[model samples]
Target: MSNVTSNSPSASNAVKPLDQGEEAVVRALHRVIHALPRAMDAELLREQGLPLVEYLTLMNLSETPGRRLRMNELAATCGMSLSGMTRVVQKLEAQGFVQRIRCEQDGRGWNAVLTDSGLARLEQAWPTNLAATRKYFLDHLAGLDLEKLAAAMRKIAT
Candidate 1:
């Protein structure tokens, strides 16, 4: 599509610029990626007294077997660095919502266990999380094929 010879390696591997419609979609996607989390965080903090990261950490922990996961696994699940998850778990531990204990399977590593209080707190916040998710995200996806969209998104994420 250019003056450069198509046989060249650079030509074959070259990236193309977005057209107008493509550019609009990409920009909107970028905006939603950045804005959705902040909006949801604001709503949860106002209504549930929980920040999105903390809520996510708690929620993820609550879903795991025995309500526990290795610290690194929890970090990965919450899209955080290990150190970041350590801080969150520390805060939750201080509030009597989570407990950090040595991983029995491997003596060197640690696990983050959701305390009974943590489950109770998550239950209290579940409605707010659901409402915020629908308001800030799902409400706009009116008649779209959600299953297909989710599959596409999962593919893109990988």
Candidate 2:
């Protein structure tokens, strides 16, 4: 047995190179991580006239209470830096999909609120997103235990 556990910090820094089987797993994961997003983004842009990041930003706002969240919180939810998220939100605002408003609870902060137009666009775009998600991600996982897969991904992410 390898002196390594999948969950072990020591395994990550171990002196030995990964054996062939282990190397193959890592290689496959690397390929999927990079390929899936690009493929999905392309599909989204082709079918929905919406980039993935924009779609995700709208979706995140739509789900929040009052259809709003603090700007920094929205940035975190979208896995973006504040400045990067600011740029995306500004574009959305320009398109009339969202608006930035001073936070009512705290005048110092800002919130990004989904506009009615954004909700309508999200409604129109949902089917395309669902189909792409299934085609690019779910369909490939046939017969695998999804909950287990999610747990494994969570472990790796952390």
Candidate 3:
């Protein structure tokens, strides 16, 4: 259970009124956080015939050793719940993009192995993903200190 129970003391304490500046920043961040993913997902769907999560799953696997990762770790890497990631992986497996194999050292766990088809899919998605990222994020931030903004984002994310 989370300590963030509604109407509890912790919840009350966790809530705080935002100052004018903070509220503006928070609202802007909130809008972008919600909107950007949708925009990117739409682009991926139209251009690559893939969903955002699928692209992310393939990309994550591609970057790892042997193009594979433990299922749990893959879930966390893609910021998905275990069951949610499992369903996505299953879809990929059905599509021949990946396969599930028994963990070499841990028989109790499974690993998601990226296939050549998955790499091809990721490659197909890359241009659209890059364009969407630039259109929604990087391009908008032009002529500012990106490092400072990145540091602020890191601070807030943590």
The most accurate candidate by TM-score is 1
State the weakest 10-residue window (summed lDDT) of model 3: 1-10
Taking all chains together, each candidate's TM-score versus the true structure is 0.90, 0.86, 0.87
Sorted on TM-score, best first, the list reads 1, 3, 2
Winner on lDDT between 1 and 3 is 1
Per-candidate count of clashing residue pairs (backbone under 3 Å) = 0, 0, 0
Model 2 stretches astray by more than 4 angstroms: 1-17
lDDT by residue for model 1 (1-158), tens: 22345686876876676677878878899999999999999999999999999899889999999999999999999999999999999999999999999999979999999999999999999999999999999999999999999998999999
lDDT of 3 by residue, 4-118 (tens): 3477666677566566787787788889889999999999999889999999999999999899999999999999999999999999999999999999896999999999998
Q: How many backbone clashes does candidate 2 have?
A: 0
Q: What digit string (tens of lDDT, one per residue) describes model 2 on residues 1-158?
A: 43345766766775786788988888888899899888888988999889999999999999999999999999999899999999999999999999999988979999999999999999999898999999999999999999999999999989
The candidate 2 region of ten consecutive residues with least summed lDDT is: 1-10
Note each model's CA RMSD in angstroms. Answer: 3.5, 4.5, 4.6
True-vs-predicted CA distance for residue 28, candidate 3, Å = 1.2
